[model samples]
Target chain A: MASVTFDHVVKRYTSDLTVVKDFNVEVADKEFMVLVGPSGCGKSTALRMLAGLESISEGQIRIGDRVINNIAAKDRDIAMVFQSYALYPHMSVYDNMAFPLQMQHMKKAEIDKRVKSASSSLGLGNFLDRKPRALSGGQRQRVALGRAIVRNPQVFLLDEPLSNLDAKLRAQTRIELQKLHRDLGTTFIYVTHDQVEAMTMGDRIAIMNAGILQQVGTPGDIYDHPANIFVAGFVGTPTMNFVAATVQDGVATASGFHVKLPKALPAAKGILGFRPEAVTDRIPDPDSAMEMKVDVVERLGSDQFLYGKVGGDSVTARVDPRIKVEPGDSIKLGLDTRTLHFFDSETELALL
Target chain B: MSVVSPATKPGSPATKPVNLERRSLLSAIRPSRAILNIVLVVSAVFWLVPTIGLAIISLRPESLFQQSGWWTALTAPSQLTLSNYQTLFAQGLVARGVLDSLITSLEITVPATLLVTIISSLTAYSLVFGRWPGRSVVFLVIVGLLVVPIQVALIPVVQEYRVFGDLSGFNPFGTIPGVVIFHVAFGLPFGIFLMYNFYSGIPKEMLEAGRIDGAGEWQLFRRVALPLGLPAAASLMIFQFIWVWNDLLVALIFLGNNKHATLTIFLFEQTRTLAANYWIISTGAMISIFIPLIVFFSFQRYFVRGVLAGAVK
Candidate 1:
């Protein structure tokens, strides 16, 4: 297994149309790096370029110490599992797994041994003799993974591999994939559009938006510290709440509420950011709290979410499940002071 | 098993005669199927009437031709004789001409079918998978050639073949190879067009997966693209085979030499004689029909749609 590196990579279809711009990342040996973004964010294009499935329009991608810009995909020593499983439908599971090794002219006994071990590891022992058409969706996905594992490539690239599975199966396979990476200890470059998959699966997550890299950090780092307003709004579930506010001399004030900034303001006016769970339902008091008229209450068994308006700004607050409230009810919610973020009005960079 | 009486069970909450009545109602559609079967059988018989008459005419003695229509002989089973077969065999009609035509037809059909299947698949693979400059334009050109008549190319092709023969010392015209070559060329445009359109529908991810599996272009075509393309290939083969098999003009013009006549030419020869040998022509026709039927039935399984069924979730 080898580390992969992309140096100032750029993909432009024409003069005006660029899909990946000045992208750079170094995936250390055995590191599971995930590229996450919304649709048309060029994550798949970046992965494809590394796989040699796409041509590099400007920069170089290196595996180990050698540049692979001109290399053929078959010579790149990387295996990709597709969102659509892309299994060979006519071949049995055993043949599908053995195909890459067989193409390399590996010995029959060795191909058989590797295929059997990979299938058994994936819990597909009983399905080796069946054609892909005979398998279910989850089983087909496992076969796709087994095919990749049997090759024992230098890097494993997965392009939204678990997106086809149902919610429960995706969760199960997510853990299984993490365990597989641990077992193999190979460099993995995974591309996905689901932020949760990226957050849960990667050692480091690279978030991209509109052909630009927004932030690159650990899951917790990205969660706790986003670099900009987009990363703040995009990274969290129920998304971070953004309020139009004015900051003056380390104190930030908004409509019907006020909070002290952790540091001096970089701008007199900007947006304030906080997570839903960072706010709590409370009784209105003179010293603290933002008064909101609750428009809807969503009780998700273990937690409750209040969707409402704080003055003119729409906001969502995560409160205790036991605290019952109704629509059209005016309530006071207190924000956690330690978790607040301030951004410049023009630049939108995190100021606090 | 419960031992309750029917009267007591009737008014019970669990008891309902509705399900049993509905079961009977569901089964009531069997008569419609039977009626449909009868109609199918009648239609099949209607279609087979001419073929049955041909078989009857082929079996009747030559002396009975002027006496009445061959259908009259069908009423008298004893009137049917194997004299047509014996006479045809005695004259070397079955022995030499039939053998020659069989070889010629096979010589034309096998190569044409194989060439069309192989060449079309490769073309389809490129049109669908290969990212090159002007791929769509190339595909449109191939599709456009499908509309050109084979008759339009016959004279020019023969002239070109003569020049090639003069330079290479191998005369393609008036030979079995000439007929096969002509058929292969004319069959290719349609073959490539049909297969290309079908191959375009195969998901691109499958090819990408094959590449990531360390398969080179040749290996990918053989193991992934070709097998997935079997249905279209089989269809192209069937089309090319039947067309070359039924062709009379190309074979007659390109294979006019005495040694290279195909079944169509042989059948034509029978009609051109002073006394047309309907018996020999009909027998030859039946023999020629046998191969295509065998080919069609043998490859019928490949034509099943959804061979790529579970390739994707």
Candidate 2:
């Protein structure tokens, strides 16, 4: 296992078409660093550059003090599990897992041993003789994983590998992957657009948008203090609600609500950001609460969400599932002022 | 254990109600299905008539073959014998001609088909995966060559062969290699076209997976691309094999009536004689047809669909 570092990496296709710009991240040894973003955000491109599958237009990538920008993909000593699962269609599961070992010219017995052990670890012992088409999506994914694991590479690169599986399988595989990382103790660079996967899996998540790296932090750090408006909105379920407001005399005021800031600040226009969970159905204080005209209510059994208009801005609040609520119902919801965030309207950077 | 009625068995209750509906549906479609089968069988038999006639004529005595239609020998089974085959295979120039023609055809078709399949597959692999400049232009040129008639190239190629013979001591004209080269040249454009299209359908991720698995370009081609392109390769082999095997024009022009004559050239020679040797012609044609039929059936299994089913999600 080795640390991976991308220093000032830039992927420029043309003068007008730069996909990944100045990407810099240091994934520590045995660290699970996830690169998460929306599609076309160049998250996959950054991973591909590190995998040596794509050329870096500028800068350097080093794996354990060895620069790999000039190396061929085969010589990179890294394995990638593609989003497509990319198992050889004509080969059986045993052969698929043994392929990398075979390419290394390893002994037959050793290859067989490694394949058997990896397959067992993946719960694919019974499927070693089956073709990929014969296996379910989840099984194929495991086979892809098994193929990577048998290589015993310094790092494992997974490009949205769980995106192809169904919801239940994805959830199960997510936990299994985390376990796999723990067992292998290898550095992993995982790329995905799913924030939940990043939040649940990553030791540190690097969020990107429009060829720019927005923020890099642990899930808790990012959730509690987003570096920018994009990271705030992109990393949460139902997303964080942003209301355009003006800060005047240390109090931020919107159309129909006002909240006192923690400290006095220069008066300026800004956006108030708050997670749905930070908005409560119970009012702690009447002065800190706002009336929300509920437009839609989603009851997810354990937790209910109210999607409605609060202070002339569309907002979502996590509420008690037992509370009876319907569309068009008006309710006073309190804002957890301590957890609220403010972003400069002009720069979209966090103001607090 | 208590005795259980059939109706109480698992799936029996649900299946019983659908049985009547399915039976009525089957009855409604049965007549058309029968008609379709009959029509298919009839068409198949119709296609086999000429081959059957050739078989009967080749089996009948040469004298009887000249005296009666092949159908007459079919009615008078006693007259039908393997004497014509025996006479054709007798120790003489006739037997030598047949044997030599078979050898020459094999020498030409085998190499032509093998070379075309191998070269086309490699070229298609490069066209699909290679990152060099002008690759598409090269592919476009090959596809453009597909439209250039082989007849148009015959004279120029023959001249070029003569010039090559003049430059070197060895002349390809009137040799099996000459005809083989000609066939491979003309066969490649279509072969490459077919294989390229097929290889393009294979997801790029499969090759990338191979690359990250520590496979070089050659290993990628040999281990991954080649296996996935079996269907197209099989088809190209069949086409090139049949085309080169049945070729009389190139063989006649390049090989002439020398010792390296192919079966088609031999057959054409027989037809050109004033007497028109019907028995040899019929028997030789059957021999020619037999080889390709064997080839087609032998490689037919590779024409399977979904060979790449498990390669990608």
Candidate 3:
């Protein structure tokens, strides 16, 4: 029942310096919500506001139904896992996890039991007596998680918890985090700059740009239908390609290709958007096809990518790894009409 | 959190090989290493020669100290006796004997050291982590106090103590507590300066994490800042203890009218005797030197470098 809500939140340092501007999001109970953006986009600041570590300048943030702006951070009943893992370097693993419970004035026997169960759940049972300096980075991160979950708080906030891990461990921990969210059934608000973590782990992600949320949707929703050029470019690997195009009557024209419009647009000049996977080697329609002067061919075992210029614009086309291709070679690529997106060049908003 | 970084973990097997290679590289420069060790050993022996000479003189009879160098007692071991120590303690350990002065010195030094260490740590905790306005200015003022010499404040503080006695029943003049107050007052500026710098190096995330973990300001200081500031505090404790312990001016002026003397004053008095009691002076000097040595040795463990290395990424 601990649904979190941010109502018209604004964090301003000065008159001209606003880090988070009129931000809003409602995280349903037992849902995993990720607030993701680029560096300095105020994602971490937003999370810190929820954790009561930072003060809100203009609006109210509520856990369940209670406003937490005036509450002290310790009484907020929300646990935060810091990016640095911020484990007490002097305390043992068991003690580090038990510190929050002890702060509540819980009895010693209850503290021991909760600490023991939390340690084993985090696979830190045997390492209870060891100090944080003795553990590896991965072990310390789990200990940080162990410390967070021992409180059984109503909401959990994580600020780039996996950013410090290497790529391999990051992927492994991402899966485990989703599982933990399910088992705990607490509202989780995670902030990160990595799109992959947001895309894979978030039940729904809120994307922000320049302190403004661009869109809020499920991963498949945002991937299949982006609201603006920023969302279209921020998500997905290799990024979605945006090509300039001119729409007249019922036909859309680019530098070296044209496509028959399925729906009419109000603007004359617009940008054409498609993913690398949408550029196929097999031609489905001739009007949307163009010859690409191949500049670099990268074979990634599972898939091959062709980087080249289509007429005057550079383009990346995903092709079969088995098909032979080389730099300086010209290949004809067809843009799939069904997945094509059109945007008003001036507004940068998706039109079709 | 990958298994990739084990360089800092002491017990990690992967780090062992790296340490081994480092050790072998050191052994490769054995010739130069041996030269450095030899130089250090030679300098150490030269440094201890005077103390060794004093210890021998303290054990020798009064007649022998006047006739020859203290080294001569080493050749005639029979001349080395405990009679000088016996005479120095004739008044007994509790009175004006050497032990009594040593006890008085401890009474003055221990409180001064502990108070500075504690108050400086608390002051530093606030200076570094507190959001109060003008904190930097306050810190600068304290650090600026470090430049003021103790001599300037000696006469003024004595007057302040006399006035305080006039207003209140308890006069700090000529008492051990008075000396302790002076030492603590002067010691705080440097103590806070050191502790403030060390506490600043601790990441703010550590304290914020503590706050989210339901800890108050005091808990954060007790659990986080205090432990991390141990090296600075240890060094401060040593400096303050040694400075106050060896001080003759403050004890001389403050302990006036009081028959009790600190070890420094007592040792000074030995040199002023009609014949200059060299045996008592040498013996008392050796005794004075031992306590600071023990204090320094006990604090050696807290001087662990890179204590903050593994605490964060």
Candidate 4:
């Protein structure tokens, strides 16, 4: 019923190298929090530490009211689903799902009831008697989820659980997982490298990089108001475009164009950031926006993306699919001044 | 395991006569197949000659064994009799020796095999999964013990066992437990080395997943590690079982004419006299071969090539 608090948790292997550095976040009760990052960002390490699989090197990790830094994993009242599913190969689906409960010495009837209910929830009711080897990848994943769900743990720690599933299944499971989270209303902390999963599933997403917490916010907040250049680049699909710019007064100037900046901005010189959608193709006057040399045009049904260069810096624009322009074409692109972000050139922190 | 074969449809081109091109290709390999089969059958018979000879000698009369080769029974079929077996039973010395030896061998082999499997699995589990200091050194030392010949340790072990026996007022030398203890100690190093390699091949995430799923150290070992380790444990069981079963030197040295005689000791006693009892020896040898084959086949199913398949993907 209580939240998880990670207070300046530092996982340092040596004095110089730290895999996780001062990671601090308080996951709310019954909230689905996702720690999203690229590979080697220590997201898995953070989750493992919380799960008591890895020891926290420094600082305290408290679940509910007790500090569990020294507690054994089994006593931590948490369950996990793994990327590889990690199903007990020798056990049948029912036995695999019931193992933790059976370890707790629950009555056989109760375990069977729980296993049956959990399996039915995951749509694996018909395959209870089958071994993990006889199941498909998606089925195995559901079994793993069912195993964790049967525990009815205080916290559900998932380390890229849906990563091994195919795209369609991953998407379907993403929705079902969100629904399962709502149904159980238990604290779920999911870790994944996929931003789409984090964006779709997390109540609040924490973006991490190189062992440091970059930003923690709602998906929209992170996408709209990224705390740094890393979060900005990491959170988006096509990635936010960053051009070398010089901040004169409050306006950020890039290439040969002068773009208006949002009022009350942090005064910084260097990189200017804007999403692909922030730059428009149609504008009355050309000098008001950036001018680009069109390079490659990618046309989808609903959207067309233009990959091009403004001066020497490469920029991408998401335009209407009807706009037809081949490579090596010069085009006038207008900047959405309201959404422009200026970042410090040296530290890459957000200026606006 | 069922393999798919081509199906011939009525209206398809497959209904036509076989093409000469494919027919010749198929037939040329056929003559070689007959020759290969003949060679295989001949070689099988050639290799089995000694076992067949032993069987015949065990069933022939003692005078016949002394008078002619075992192949003589094939030419003079009527000369075959069960007199050797009757004589073996009537004397009762070989029977008691064989039974004693079997009990002794089983006493040594079962525990030795079991101890090696349990100890190796525990050691391998810790070496692969546990976070401790100098595990690699410990593992390396265990593997290093593999090269140390059992003969090198026999004198010292005997001396130590003698000292231990004196302290406890119960001697271990020329005892069944001593023989079993010696075999277990010597068999452990290779067993641990083998199981360690195997356990290391399992993905670390599975164990981590187990830990997060609320499985403690013992529970993780019992539930996750041990079940997954069956293939390794089975092979190790077979290896240790056969090794201890076939062992004569360690038993001969440590168990020295003890009342609890192993099969090897029983076999050795037949050759002890000036006139070796070939009839008893052959019968006893065949009986000794019987148990190992059974043990091998029992564990043969676990020798599956890919137990780890379909586990991850």
The models' CA-based lDDT, in order, is 0.86, 0.90, 0.90, 0.86
Q: Lowest summed-lDDT stretch of 10 residues in model 4 chain A?
A: A260-269
Docking class of 3: medium
Tens-digit lDDT string for candidate 2 (A1-352): 9999999999999999999999999999999999999999999999999887889999999999999999999998999999999999999999999989999999999999999999998899999999999999999999999999999999999999999999999999999999999999999999999999999999999999999999999999999999999999999898998999899998899876898888677899999888999888877767778989999999999999999997679989999899999899999899878888999998999988
Which stretch of 10 consecutive residues in model 1 chain B shows the poorest summed lDDT?
B1-10
User: Which candidate wins on lDDT?
Assistant: 2
Interface RMSD of each: 1.0, 0.8, 1.1, 1.5
Clashes in predicted model 3: 1
- TM-scores for every candidate against the unseen true structure: 0.93, 0.95, 0.93, 0.92
Q: Evaluate every candidate with DockQ and list the scores.
A: 0.73, 0.74, 0.60, 0.60
**Candidate 3 residue-wise lDDT, A5-38, digit = tens:** 9999999989999999999999999899999999
Better of 1 and 3 by lDDT: 3
Over 4 Å off in model 1, which ranges?
A282-286, B1-43, B81-83, B89-96, B274-276
lDDT of 4: 0.86
The alpha-carbon deviation from the true structure for residue B72 of candidate 3, after best TM-score superposition, in angstroms, is 2.2
Once fitted onto the true fold, the runs of candidate 4 whose alpha carbons sit more than 4 angstroms away are A264-268, A284-287, B1-46, B72-83, B89-96
Q: Give the lowest summed-lDDT range of ten residues in model 3 chain A.
A: A258-267
Give the per-residue lDDT digits (tens) of candidate 1, residues A107-168.
99999999999999999999999999999899999999999999898999999999989999
List the candidates ranked by lDDT, beginning with the highest: 2, 3, 1, 4
